[model samples]
Target: MINWKYCIIGAALVVVLGMLFRMMFEYGVLIGILIPGVIVGYLVNNGYKNGAKNGIITGIIGGFIQGILVYITIDLNLPPFPAVISYILVFALFTTATSAFLDAVGGIIGALIRDKI
Candidate 1:
């Protein structure tokens, strides 16, 4: 069974982090929606029971989705449709893995804090 509360809070935190990153970076996937969603997913899945392994898996899955969405949506803000489509296949694998790891770290931190509080 999944813990909806943790998931919701973690996801919300991620969204807030994303917005903040967006504001700071102005653009780019890092501070965008990618990290936040991934972090939340990782946190939610790990719950307060199991530990890092679950978080890692959640992060990997969430990050993949986020990366793909970011890749697809980036073009919405720019021109040259082909340019956007062209790179889609390029970064998919690497970015997903990277985001997953990053989110996993965040999840660990969030879980620790959540347990304390």
Candidate 2:
């Protein structure tokens, strides 16, 4: 079973840390993605039977939020039309997939460690 609470918490942390690193130190967004990935990994691995799925869920939430922020920050001066929607969709999909892959890897590693110890 998926735990929504942990996923939301993880996503919140990702956004907060991501923005902080992005604004404060000029660090890459991947660093922000990575921290929450580890966190979601740890959380999901605790009770869930499928770490990858949980991680994907967590990533989707965090990535969606992050992607929206990115979209808002970017000065895409395209005409307000269907094109804007397409752009947002594509951007959202890309971010979500990337984050999901990274988070899944982290989740698998976390699950392994949890099992071992």
Candidate 3:
């Protein structure tokens, strides 16, 4: 059975880490990916496949939320709701796509580590 709780946890972790890394190192993905991956992997004893699935979910949720926040913080003067929604979706889709693969890889590694430990 799949545990969505871990997915939500992973997403929250990624979102928080994304902010911290972006502020400190200017590179956000690394901090978000491996940490959440390992956490999900450790908490859930599923194999790498499942780990990857959860990690992808985490990336999608976290990335989209972060995207919305990013759009809000940006100086884009588009104040209308629909326009803002469109841009948010676009930003989210791009960020999710960019982060998903590495996030999945992190999941795989994390699962492997879990198995070893």
Regions more than 4 Å wrong, model 3: 76-82
Q: All models: lDDT? A: 0.53, 0.73, 0.75
Q: How many backbone clashes does candidate 1 have?
A: 0
Name the best candidate (by lDDT).
3
RMSD of each: 5.2, 2.5, 2.0
For model 1, residues 1-117, the per-residue Cα lDDT tens digits are 445555445445444554456557766446543455444544554453343444445445545555565566555575476865557755556666775566556556555665665
> Which residue pairs clash within candidate 2?
none
Model 2 alpha-carbon drift over 4 Å, by segment: 24-27, 46-49, 76-78, 115-117
1-117 per-residue lDDT for model 2 (tens digits): 677887788778767776777776665677777777666767666643466667778788888888778776774576587878788778878888887877777666666667776
Q: How accurate is candidate 2 locally (lDDT)?
A: 0.73
- Tens digit of lDDT per residue, candidate 3, span 1-117? 457998888878877887777777756656765677678766777899888887788777777787677667764687688877787888878877755665677677788888998
Candidate 2 lDDT score at position 56: 76
